[model samples]
Target: MAGRQRWMTVVCVVGVGMLTTAGCDGTAEPAAAPTSAATRSVTPPVPRDLFSPRPEVVRTPQEACGGTPFRAGAVRAYTPDGPRYDGPGPHPVKLLRMESDLLGMGPELPYQWTGPRPAQLVVCEYEDETFDSRQVGTCEYLGGTVLGATARVQSARFVYRVFEARTGTLVRQFTLRGNTTPEETCPETTYAKTALYDQQVESKDLVAKIRPLVERDR
Candidate 1:
């Protein structure tokens, strides 16, 4: 009888030990992993100047020749180190707009390219391109190529150059001087905001008016 009682105690002790072990195991919790350093470090985007790969010019080459009227000046041809003037110069075409009718272009703004991408594909492409700052900023020091324009006293500068990405041929261009600076840097923004009512429209207006002076026999 004592032997049987001792066996029962041994069994109960074993069961109690097992139950205690299981309860301890159930109460234990797992530890979490550590987070990365980036979770603590964050930064913001600020505007600054940088080099651009586009061609720039101060004067148009096909200027109002009573010549090509658009005057793809040294800047247009993509070589000029300085501006172009009318009269006997290396580039014959001079004077972008000679008519007195286009002085008020800032009223009706003409749509132009901006940069950095804002909302969707098309609208985001032209976010920062407007040059309303009236300050001189650009990729002026890049060594690839350069174009510039000059008048009797004043010369113009374009911060961005528009070229056929497919063929590399020069197309349209925008300046960082006026209120028409380019916004985003994406190449796909070429088709967005096809036109605006500012100086761009004024330039086109002058071109349309002088079409007869330079539009050749083609």
Candidate 2:
């Protein structure tokens, strides 16, 4: 598919309220006169989308391997930033599960078991989903009690590319986008716990798609 530009627009609305003081006689005093200043509207620059369009296979494994019944001395996995552990604690459960899922595919794959001697490389680039709360607006109660309203947003993405070890040429590529829904809450509540591995794409599914490229039809 041809690549297209993607953009996300975030609109923030702010509300201002006047403050009143309570008099000793149980009467409310009028708020102080408000100060005004000349204001000019300035356009903020749009941020470029951090995600990219799903990439198509540049070269089939059969083509790169020179024929069908592709065989390799060894196939290895590589990650640019390596495995990431959140904070100082032990590795996250979902992260370990994902790694186990990849390892499970080794038996079915065509390549022999070896890591140092790489005949083909599966490069994995992953972005962990993050959740955060941002104040979107304010809520005022009948008693003039004001509370901040917050929005929680989650986002993540992953990219995998296969390459011929000897030639260092890319053969296949895939991209996985994270599934996220924005949630808003009044009184600025803390963000809810989110699953670390809740992604649209699964390891097995990815292996199924790429298996054909690496294995010859029997």
Which model scores highest in TM-score? 2
lDDT top scorer: 2
What are the C-alpha RMSDs, in order, of all predicted structures? 24.7, 28.2
In lDDT terms, how accurate is model 1?
A: 0.26
Error of 2 at 25 (Å): 99
Q: TM-score for all predictions?
A: 0.15, 0.27
Return the lDDT, model 1, position 41.
54
Candidate 2 residue-wise lDDT, 1-218, digit = tens: 13877785532222245342324354544444444554545667654453554443333333333322223432222232233212332111111122224323111232331233323344333333333323333322232224323333334454445554434345666665543223221222333232122223444555565655444322
Which portions of model 1 show Cα errors greater than 4 Å?
1-69, 77-102, 105-169, 172-218
Cα-based lDDT at residue 34, candidate 2: 48
lDDT of 1 by residue, 82-117 (tens): 322222212112232322123322212122211221
Candidates' C-alpha lDDT: 0.26, 0.36
